[model samples]
Target: MKRLLSALLATAVLAGASLTARAETVDITMAAGHPPVFRWVKHANQTFIPAVNKALEGSGITVNWSEQYGGSIAKVGGVLEAVEEGLAEVGLVSSLFEAAKLAPQNVTYFTPFVSSNATAISELMDRLHEENAELRKSWEENNLEYLGAAIGIDDYLLMTTFPVNSLDDLKGKKIGAPGPAVNWLKGTGAIGVSGNLTTYYNEISTGVYDGVIVFATAAVPGKLYEVAPYVTKVGFGAQYAGGIAANKEWFDAQPEALQNALRRGGVAQREAYHKDLDQAITASLEAIRANGGTVTEVSPEFRMKWAAGMENVAKAWAAQLDGEGKPGSSVLSAYMDAMRKDGATPVRDWDKE
Candidate 1:
């Protein structure tokens, strides 16, 4: 009886040791600049993280997710810095807002009149990331690893109190724009107010600005329609990619299989994001109209006029980059070539072509 009890006790100890060995955990934190309700953050938390964990299931690895939305960790302008500093292991970065740091990659957003279709833009972005080694290196230099790109809502439109049927209608108006959009205000005679969708409502309400340059998906959730009530779709163009980025330091420390799982999860999340954006835009437009907002389709002639007026911004952007010794000219050229290849007839030379 003593011998049998000793054997059973030894077996129990071995079992406990094995269980402890298999219980390794990896905690990764992700952040987004928008509030929790914004589609980007909502989708990342609800759809992306879960898919990532599931992809790693049964691999003896577990992920602890920490999400910081509403600028809790990084505001829109500060995401890249936040990720690089290890404030969050992973984050949703806005290339548009980081043009100075991500000059070449972010230029895609400045190339107006490209296809407004999300799928095409998403595919183009994926191709760009694959084709441009330098572009990928840009992210790497910042101590971040690119996962996959997610498309923003369709082209920007003017949500204002006044109806803008033509370029002439915008003169002397106070237009709230984010980051690079300030340049968009140059030739139009409209006063440019730097603001984002998060503060758009308050800015408009407090008379800080008259209206905003924003997309529809955000309009509904932000309730901008309740205040401004006029959505003039300028068909400005589709916004190129923004996406999941992991701190390279943290990402490289993960096991190879786990890293692959995270990458696959990012691809899946991007696909889901595109799908959600389509539905969200439809719902947002409906919500806008329901709130007594006017949705008007700008005539092609008018759109052309608006596009023509903003022709100089590209050159200005390229020159600024050239001054910094970055590959501003080469990047801009590549993007324009790609745009034309994608059936876009840009109104002006984005890179003097």
Candidate 2:
């Protein structure tokens, strides 16, 4: 009778252990390079995170977000590495900033004057990711999984101390441009200064640059009006969708249902981002004007000149990619074709055929 009781007790302990294991929870952490006050963070907090949590409400998996904005965990340029090293389970990566790391993806940004419409640009990026396996593999090799992409503000404009009515007006001026945007500043004779959206405010105020290449939405929030108050919408073209990527290892460890929830969150975040951007553009313009800034719409003639000047950057970028053994030329051609199909007439041939 005692022996039988021992056996039953052992079985009960085993059952309890199994139950504990089944009740274990999965947790995830996400990081963004922008500050909490920035639109990226605002949207994530107000829209993205809540939507994701709601999607995963009964999934038994919990996501704990760690917002390391303003260069806390990773600087704007270091976000890719941050995720690769597992500093955070997921992160916001600016393809425009990490052009070399995300080559084919950044092509959309290199080719300026392609399309200023946010919707078209977002669709193009999503299609590019879906159609190209290699592009997806690039993220995998870096220990990350690309979830969803979100478009930044519309094409960049020149925010300067002086009014820029023509391409000639940019001559000899020092303009702060992010990595790919430097290519857009070529032939205008403007001295291109490497800068990021994070540093633009202080740099502009300290006279580190005469102006900055930025979008109206960012300018208003960054309070760029106090420094370079003249806003010029030069129709430079829209930026490709930035992405939310996760550490592949961390992602794989999650339950299948939890993984699906994160993806659904990504989709919701992308839609919310675009919608917010559209609304922010109008509000930003008004806010900038209200804050004592000047906004100007560049003429079509000047827009054409600006577009023509930056045409060769696309070819140069393609060659740079070819040298890297990636399908840069092919990607550029495909993207140009897609853009044209979407009603964007290219100012220059991407293939030169």
Candidate 3:
């Protein structure tokens, strides 16, 4: 009987130790410049956070998440800085805002008219980060560890107060575009005004701009239809706006098991982001059309003409990077090559030019 009691006591003590070990928690703060309204933010909250928590379940480690979003911890365009400075252990870094800082990483932005598949674009971007050295360098230079990409908008669209039937409709018009995208307006005869989603509505409403080069996903919630209800589907191609990034020091400090959990969660988040983006693009465009808005699909011929008319921004973009010895040309060539291999026939091969 005494031996039985001793055995039971030992079992209870071991169980307590195991429970205590499993209760260990690691606290991490994740931040995003944009609010939780968009698909990227939504997936981060509903999918990614839950995914990580689930991955670590019964692994003797748990994460305490501090989610800061919607310009709460950092304003839009400042996520990279916040993460680099370790203000947030992880963040969603916007390449759109980091054009100058992450030039090579913005290959999708420079070479448009290639893809409209959000899933393909997101997966390709993640694969490129894994395979491309220069792409990896961009993150390392900024003291970030790339996890997976979060592509918000599916394809670029043009919204204007006036209906657009042809390229001539854009002549002498002042159209707003986000950073670096202003180059897309070159040779279109329309003056490109540097603008962001935040100011697109007010700018158009106040006559600060006549139209905007934007996306359907953003346009619907932005209530841009009230100001610029004319939506033109130009097939400007889906883009990589931002992605998950971690402070290098912080990431390296994590245990291997924790690192694996984060990586798994990041990939899951990317997939969720693309699926949601695909759904959002459809729903948002439908919402716009239902609200007395006009949706027009630009002809393939017109798209080709537009692509040809634009300043060989791709060539110049790559050359500028080549001059800086930043692997710009190589990334350009490789990206276009990959797209072609994936059965994409771009209106203009930005790299070959």
* Backbone clashes, each candidate: 0, 0, 0
1-353 per-residue lDDT for model 1 (tens digits): 99999999999999998875655677788888878787767878877888888888888788878889889999987888999999999898887778767777777566776667766677677678878887788789899898874555577778997777666677888999877767766677788887888789998888888888888988888889888998988776667647788999989988886788878877877788888888777788888888899999878887677777775777777778789777677778887778778887765656774
At residue 168, candidate 1 shows an lDDT of 67
The residue pairs that clash in candidate 2, if any, are none
lDDT of each: 0.79, 0.80, 0.86
lDDT of 3: 0.86
User: How well does each candidate superpose onto the true structure, as a TM-score?
Assistant: 0.89, 0.91, 0.92
Best-fitting candidate, scored by lDDT: 3
lDDT of 3 by residue, 1-353 (tens): 99999999999999998866655788789998877876788788998889988888878788889999988989878899999999999888888888877888788888889888767777877898899878989889989998885564588999999999999999999999888888889988999998888778899999999999999988887899999999999989888786899999889988787888888889999988777777777899899999989999999999999998888888898899989879888898888888889888888888876
Ranking by lDDT: 3, 2, 1
Q: What is residue 13's positional error in candidate 2, in angstroms?
A: 6.2
